[model samples]
Target: MEYNEFITHVQTLTQSDSREEAERATLAILKTINELVPDEEMQEIAVQLPQKLGEILREKETKSNQSFNLQEFIERASQKENIKPTTTAIHARAVFSVLQSSITPDVFTKFHKYFSHDYEELFFTSP
Candidate 1:
């Protein structure tokens, strides 16, 4: 997807008030993923995304050991995006949904493998 289409999907999925909100959420999640996924894996995921969106993942380098769990992951994005922790999960799922749909399945499988099983919850909304 193009950057606008990706932002639109995120806004629609998260029910954001504007494009900026969706963009912020997208960056927050992408940066958070940058901290979690290894460099090689992240590079693979980045190449499949829109240039602008991929740049966020490429530009932000994290020295974190990536020892955090799912809850911590949400909290980090919430803090970075300057949104409520409760809402961060919603934004994260929206971003993940967009990522899954936009990228190749093989690359997505590789991306998904980096996160633990509990993190799978971020990929889908609660039923």
Candidate 2:
């Protein structure tokens, strides 16, 4: 996915009217997610994304405060985006759904391993 495609798909997927909104949601999602997974795993995932987005994730991957779990991840994401937990899930699912199509299956598989099965519903947009 290229930069425009990645951002557009996320905006369309999340039904966001503003470009900044989509960007914020994506940044929060990626930043929060990178905090949960190992940097190596995120690097694998990032290489498959658009350069801009890959850089975004990579920048976040090196944070010292990366010990948060799924629930804390959501909380931080929600706070970043100024939304509720449920709304954060919507944003995260938008990005994850894009990631599903963009990254290798194995990378996404590794992503899920960092969390419980409860995250499946949040990380994948069901058909």
Candidate 3:
């Protein structure tokens, strides 16, 4: 799927009243996306993924960090010609890509599926 579409998908899958549930769902999606894409592209995406995901996952804590504003960081990074805007899906794909590089593809696949399944459970179980 395209970047925007993927972000929308993640948003849908992650909708929850509880921030903890949303964060877990987002992390699951990120792990899956990381397993499915390529290395170079993953590295590019990684520049923004951790921060963006961190924001959604750690809303209050991240705010207090002073240096954890992913959106602002992305905006500044985008000012450079080489850096692309970090969309939700792009961040997911980047995470997968980085994982692919760091771990064996087989392990990544297993972990991705496991996380995806766990997120699905959380998404459904949430009130």
Candidate 4:
């Protein structure tokens, strides 16, 4: 999807009042993923997304840090998105939902494999 369409979907899914809010939330999740997944794996997923989103995923240069769990993931994203921890999961679901729909199944699978079973909960929540 194009960047605008991607952001619009995020906004619609999260019911954010402004595109900017959705964009920030989306980037927060993407950036978190960038930090969690290895650079090569992240690059694989990034190329499949819109240019802007891809760039966001590639913004970080460090190696992946997979030590953290789901709660820490939520906390990091909440802080980055500037949203409450209570609502971060919903926003994160919106971001991942948009990602699942936008990319090829293969690419999504590659991205999904990086997260453990616990992270699967984010996928089921209402966006």
* Top candidate, metric TM-score: 1
| Inter-residue clash pairs, candidate 2 | none
Candidate 4 yields a Cα-based lDDT of 0.85
Pairs clashing within candidate 4: none
Candidate 4 residues lying further than 4 Å off, grouped into runs, are 124-127
Task: Give candidate 2 misplaced runs (Cα > 4 Å).
Answer: 61-69, 125-127
Task: Give per-residue CA lDDT, model 3, range 6-115, as digits (tens).
Answer: 34444444343444433444455443333333443344444443455423323221122223233443343334213345444343433344434444555444443434
Off by over 4 Å in 1: 125-127
lDDT of 4 by residue, 2-55 (tens): 999999999999888999889899989898888798888888878888998998
TM agreement with the true structure for every prediction:
0.92, 0.86, 0.31, 0.91
Q: Global lDDT of each model?
A: 0.87, 0.81, 0.39, 0.85
Worst 10 residues of 1 by lDDT: 58-67
Q: Which ten residues in a row have the lowest lDDT in candidate 2?
A: 60-69
- Local error of candidate 2 at residue 20 (angstroms): 1.1
Model 1: per-residue Cα lDDT over 1-127, one tens digit each = 8999999999999998889899999999999989988778877888989999888877756663376889989999999999899889999999999999989989988888878888987775337
Whole-structure CA lDDT of model 3: 0.39
